[model samples]
Structures are given as C-alpha cells and as structure tokens.
Target chain A: MGGSTVEPVVRESVGSAPGNLAIASLARTLRCVECGHETRLEVHQSCPACLGPLAVTYDLSTLRGSVPSDRLSGRPRSIGRFAELLPPLSLPWSARLDLETTPLRPAPRLAEWLGVETVWLKDDTVLPTGSFKDRPASVAVAFAAAQGHRAVGCASTGNLAAATARAAVRASLPCFVFVPAGLPDSKLDPVRQFGGQIVEVEGPYDVANRVANLAAEAAGIGVVNITLRPYYTEGSKTLALETFEALGWNPPDAIALPLGSGALLAATERAISQLREIGWIPSGPGPALLGSQPDGCAPIADAFDAGSDEIVPVEHPRTIAESLAIGDPGSGYEALRAIRASRGAADSPTSEEVIAAIRALARTEGIWVEPAAGTVIATLRRLREAGTVRRQDRVVAFLTGAGWKISHAVALSRVGSAPIHLDPVHPDLSQLHVGPRPEALGGAE
Target chain B: MTTLVLASVLRQSAPSLHQKEYDGFRGSLLEFLNTVSAEGGPSFRGRIFDGDRLRRYLNVFVDGTDVRYLSGLATPITPTSRVDLIPAVAGG
Candidate 1:
C-alpha cells in the first residue's frame, strides 16, 4: 500500500498563469547522442545539425535545494508536483490527474514465487488511459500545448493512442493517432471515446508507423513519439523517480523492465545515474538492469545474446504482445549498451511462457497484465535459474499496462477460463467443480 | 555485395534489408548515402552527413558494429557485408 505521495487532506487549488507563456524546462540543452553537439532545448526531435537522438541533460545542483521542500509533499500526487528535475512546461496544475502517482507495492506472494527477498511491482496500469503511455503522453501534449501547437498526434501500437488522445483532450487540442488496422477495438474504441480521431493504416504496426512519420514531416503535426520525442521520451524517468521515492530512497538490487524500443530500460539507467550524481542514492553497485521481451520480436535480447553491437532489423515482428512487437527498434543500441554496462542479461520468453506468466501474476498477485509486462515475469522466472537474479536481491518488476486492453485476445482464448453455461437451478456453489489450472501454473516452478 | 539495411524512417523513401542488393559495390559509406539520397533517400547534403563524417541523427553500422565505434563511414565493407542505417528516433 506504500505509494510515492503523502499529501494533506485538503489541498489549495492550483492557480493558472496569465497568458500561455512557454516556460523554460530546467533542461536547457540537448546533447546529440552521436555527435555530442548541444542545442537549445524546446520541443525538438533529432538534433538539427547531426540528426542524432538528442539526450536531455539537466543541472542537478539547481534541484537539490528545491526538490525536497515541504510545500511539494503537501500537494496532490502528480508528475507536475515533481517538476524540479523534469522538463520545463506550464502544466495545468489545476487538473487533478496529470501523470498521477502510481503504486510501487511490495509483492510478498510474488517474492515467494520468484524466490527474491522483496519483490516490488511498479504498477503503471491504473492511469487514466490504463497504461504507462500516460507518463509520456501527458508531458508531450502539455509541452505541445504550451508551445502554441494547434493540434497533436502520434503513431501508436494502441496504448499510446488513447493516452495521447486523453492528454490532448485535457489541453483542449484535437488529437490524431495513427495505428495499424489490425489493432483490436478494445484499444481503438477508447481513443474515439476520448475524442481522438484514429487513422487506421492498411498494414502492420510498422508500416502505420512510417505513414505517421511522413505525416509528422509534411503537416508539421506534433507527433508525441516522433516530433516531440526529446521531451516525450524523457517522461519515462518519472517511473524510476516514483519507484525510488516509494522505497524511501533505497535503490533496489535489480529491476526487470518490459522491453519495447528499449527506451524505457535505458531511461531507467539514466534516472539511476542522475539520482546517483545528485547524491539522492549512494554510489557503488547500482541495480542490475534486466530487460525482457517475447521471442516473437526480441531484437535487443537476441542481439545481446549473440553479443552483437548492432541491432538487426526485424522487418516483420510477430507477437501476441502488440506493444513490444516493434521489428526495427530506434533505441535498441542504447538499451543494449545499458544492459551490458550493468553486467545484466537480456532474455526472451516464448509466447506460451509469456501467457503463462500473465496468468500466474493474476492468480498469485491479483494483477492481470498483458503479454508485454508478462515477459518481465517470465524472464525473471528464467533468470532465477541462471543467477542473473538471486534470492537475496530486492527486485522490482515494472508492470507497464493493464490486461483489459488485451482481454479479448487472452481472456476468451480458451474454453476452461471462459464462462460456463449454467441453468437456473445450478446457482449453488457446489455445482462449480473447478480443478487446478494447469494453464496458469505451467511456469510457476 | 553490401546490403544496407535501412531503418523504418529511411525505409519510407528507400528500401528495406531484403528488398534490394548492393553486390560488388565499391565506395565509402558517404558515397552510398549520396547514391541513396539521389534516389530520394535521406538527404545527406550538409544535413545528415558531409564529405567525410556523419552529421546528426543517422547511425551507420558496418556488419553488426557501429561505424563510429569502428572507423566512421570509412569502415571497410566486404562484398557480403550488411550495413544498417538507423535514425535517432525511438518507436513505441
């Protein structure tokens, strides 16, 4: 039940500033990842001069005195409340929900199952959009709105579509999210409900992604992950920040992250190093950063296993985990470097193992996750045997999204877990003869 | 043959890994960029790369190692090498 925030019962309303003045994010310059060229920070994509991904660096000395203030703790739980270390933007602090604080609960049962001493679940599933995309989408939309952008859009697998739309709606901007036509209605319907227009492409998620980039280039649309990426990707550090705060500033021994483009795992590494530099956490042995993926599209994992420095493009990634099904990941190199530096290991669990892990988390911990997060659980299970994770280490598994988003593909897939036809007289509890669920318990050992 | 595996962003204009071939090609990676740009690939004319070094967002890998880690665009390639051209963009 321990979370990141401790606020007063009654809070003062957040006031609005006169005229939408674009406030400077404490992050002043973005250093090009490849060329090391620095540029003035705003809503930026790749570096203008070098075209390499720009890395946002902040002066931690400025925040050391301001971050631990008593006034911040008394306010409600939101990402804006901890804006001292984040990118500069005038968020509607008046709104109750903007990257609200998520739970980092200790899972005793899960610890016993994984054989770790203290296993924690950083559940990002309870956001307004039912996914972790809320973190980046909230920041990107706010940054775009503050910069006087008339509209916003993004290319998404599904989770971000709804998240960007919801964030855009909060800022009173029309949202356009392009996704593959194959995405389920459970994912697409929410975007419509949140007033986001969906442009369904007639191909897989990869092709749809290309069209979105082209749109971002031609129409000058503020694509959350494309055009506004410097700020958008930086939003993931909040996850690491929240986790550290939840544990009372004690860093865990290991963290298992669900791998996609490999940005989240790399971002976790950046957060760990930043916190260390500012003396928030002690220096020495940092947490072993572990990354997991389904075998269907495990480019980073496969590359790490083969000890290859370059990421081979996965042109047609096939997987039940729609979120992690990126064939050609943009940050594959960064994630691979972080994992290697931490002396950590990466692995891919088969789709069956991923499904079993999903059911195991639900059965044991009452947490239903899609295959994306399930890869972490399944990978940790394997790591327990390989000594990448040990019984003495305190582990944190990041549950990135909720199960309802993929319930159609998972819940009703089998007959045993489905609803049984019952007659009126069969209402008695004795009529239900449910035995052991081998499906869920397949990978428990 | 040096097969250049372009990223999704570059694949928008150029071809993917298997779609094309660069058999028995002899040139530096910069010339390859100009050739691709001439064919409507990412324009490296003082924007992405110059005569000698790559400029901003694009990364080139000879075989499976980054050219920056190897020898920049001057990294030699074999007839059967696979080079990857990736942008600095991160996908979801």
Candidate 2:
C-alpha cells in the first residue's frame, strides 16, 4: 500500500508577453543532461559536455494565465490550443497539422465490469495516426522545422513511425523510419501511405534505434524521439491537463497508464503537479498513478522490485503490444521517481491477460484497443480483483491507441467472427451468425 | 574465423553466469551490448573498453543463467553458446 509520497509542488513560470518571442526563441538553447549546463543546441544528438542527451527548457510562467477553459474553443482543434503550455512554435499554425483533441469518453461498462466507479477512456484511436505518438510527433516536427531542420526520423516499433510519417509528410520534411522487420503490416501500412522512407533493421527494436543518433547529428535531421525530446515530451502533458479539465476540474483517484518509453506517465505526473501549483486546481489528495507494461518487456517493473533506480535492458521484446515494445526506456528512472513520488503502483500483465482484456473492452465498452491499451485495462482489472483499486475510487483507464491500428492482435483474440465467405448477394446474411442461430440452417443440416 | 562470445540473462529461477568465449560472436556480442546500452536506453557511465557496468536490473546470460553465477564478465565463451541480455520482465 505504501507508494509515492506527496512532495512540495513547484511550478516553473512562463512569463505572459504577447509578441514577445523570448519563450519560443529560447527553445534553441540546449541544457546538458548530466550536468544541466546550458548552451546552444547541438547539431548532433549528443551533448557537447558529456555526450548526454540535451533537453529543451520552457518558459512555463508565460503560459500560466494563457490557457483558459474557452481559449481553445475557437482555436484549431489540436494540442496546440494548449500552445501556451508548450515550447513556443515558430512555424505558422497551419503549416503544422493539428492532431490532438480526440474523443475522451467514459467507459462505464468497462468500469462496472472492473467494479470501479467513474472510468474514462482517453480514446486516441481517432488521431490521424491512430496512436498517442501523434501528440509528440506533431510538436517535435514543428519544433524541428522551426529550428530549420529539413529531414526527420525515428526508430519505431510501429506507432511512432506512423505518427512521424504523417507529421513529416504534412510538414514537407522527408522522413526516414527504422523499424524491426517483425512488426505487423497493419502498423506499417500507414507509415508507407504517408511516404515515409522505411528501413527494416535485422535485429530488435533497440538495434533499429542505432541510426537515429548519428543521423540526427550528421544530417541535422530532427529525430523526434532524440533531439526534440524535451519539447516533444511536452505534448503528453496535455493528456493529464485535458483529463482533469474535462472531469469538471476534478482529478481522478487513480490514473492507469500504459508504459513504454515512460514519457506519457512522466508528463502526466508533471502536469498534475503543475496544475495544482497554479491554483487552477486545488491539490489535496494526490491521485494514485499506476503504470502498465507487458510482462515480456518490463524493465521498470523489475527495477522497482529490486528497489533500484537503474534500468536493465532487455535484448528482445516478445509482446503482442509492439508499440510498448521498448526494451529500455530513457526516462525509466524518472518514471520510477514520479510513480514512487505519487505513491502509485506498477503492473506488468502477461500476453494472455493482455489479449483477454482487449476482448473485454470491445465487448463491454464497445471500445476496441491495441495491446498497449489492453495491457492497461487488463492490469486495471487485475488490480481491482486484488483490491489495489477500491470500488469507490474514481479511476481512469487510459486507452492509448485504437484497436484498428493493431488489428493483427485483435484478429488473434478470436472473439470476433472470422471472415465470412458470403457472396455479394448474401451480404445481408453476415449478421445471421450473430444472436441465436437461425433454426433454418440447423434443419437444413 | 573464431572470436570470443559471451551471453547472459537475469532470472529468479537461475543465477547469473558467463561461460567460455567461443568463435564468430565477438563482433555481434560487442555491438549488441554497446549499442543496446545507449539507444536502448539506460546510460552506463563507464567506457566500453574500460569494462561494462551493467545497470541495476540488467542480466547478461551466455546460454540461460546470469553471468554473476558463472564468472561475471570474465565468464568463458565458446562458439556454440548463445548470449542474451534479458530485460527484467517483472510483474505480479
């Protein structure tokens, strides 16, 4: 029951100044990862001081009063509406496509099935790329373009490449996507549709990631996950911000999130702290944060058990949830700190649980989800059964991506009917297999 | 033709071990471990030539068990042995 404790909440301010590009311009400055030394952003992905990854700094105070409830109503429908909360975007708003603001629906049936009250789904499947990666990819690409970087790339399992391709194509930035060949075609099709330069690496997800650092440095390409990480990660904060605002400004008792690279979980925790500090929302009882990962690649979960902050790297990722297939997460340490600080728990469910959860969501909630989302929902069920989440708790189960995105896994679930061999004339009979089977067929047999 | 290879995995069921170095794996093992360290996430401060400082939950397995049980990094390797870096697949 002992989890993260509430610490003194601090809010970094982004000064309020219209037409004052100070906050936006400062994005070019890069801070050292190891020593936190501030300097000009490096062309190579490596930090000049210790070869560490560089993070972008933001003027959060300027954004303090910039975002109001109705501010986004008339603005473009995307994460940019909360632009004041993010790194300043240099490109014209139209040049950068808006891909946020999807349907965040309440999953009452799923909640009832899990026996938890007030469950909400941050349905990101409606996103242009059908994954939460679009939130970060859009911001990262825009930041990269603003910095005058032409080409962009990323090492992806499946979702990141699709999101990056959509962002890159819209921005006219030629994109190169490196992925492990083991990825299913359903996830690959969207990337190619966006004209991405796809490269299939021989090894696992980690092996495909090798080219990003060098290319980001040598070619000055904006590798979203690498060079633009600081700004890119800011995109995930919107999920927390929007979720709280949407729920009548009331934070949930617990947030169940999918953990892969750990950016989403870390950002959500940061956003909650930031909102509480600004007085926009009163901070009293902190919500419990729980992270879900596939039992196959759960380095953070493993480290937590060992009571170690250091993350172990897994050679191979063997999970149906390919999007969450990151064997090693750069932000794993920060994720651990945040989860512990929030007094939250971590769960890694087996592939069987992941599959079963996926079926349950579609059946009860009519919301189909990919394996990562299934992992969260499934773990939420397990926790409920274990009494980790009480029946009275206000729980929100994050459905990160659409079931349509990872149709392969859904097909494997076998809960849905197999392809019917009906001819064009018999299309009406497709529904015949549903409900009670017609006695006519039985009698004919 | 022949090169030293090492593989290790961390699991509760088995202790860590490093076996004898074998042929045709020196290049692949080194590349896998080194590249896997940075891009795969978890930064190890020590230089590759200096030696490996495996992260907290990291388990290097030559065939099945961890290298800690066999000989740490000094575990012997042979061509027939397979090396693997097992991620901590921890969950209840």
Candidate 1 — which pairs collide? A25-A88, A50-B55, A50-B56, A50-B57, A51-B56, A51-B57, A52-B56, A52-B57, B1-B79
Docking model 1 quality class: acceptable
- Ten contiguous residues minimizing lDDT sum, candidate 2 chain A: A1-10
DockQ of each: 0.27, 0.05
User: Cα deviation of A111 in candidate 2 (Å)?
Assistant: 0.6
DockQ of model 2 vs. true complex: 0.05
For residues A301-365, write the lDDT of model 2, one tens digit per residue: 77876788667767677889888888767667667878888888888899999999988888876
List the candidate 2 regions with Cα displacement exceeding 4 Å: A1-36, A39-55, A62-67, A70-74, A93-95, A416-445, B1-92
lDDT of 1 at A249: 75
Range of the 10 consecutive residues with the lowest summed lDDT in candidate 1 chain B: B10-19
Clashes of 1: 9
lDDT of 1 by residue, A90-199 (tens): 64622423666899877877777777777899999898888898988887787788788888998888999999999888888899999988798889889999999999
DockQ of 1: 0.27
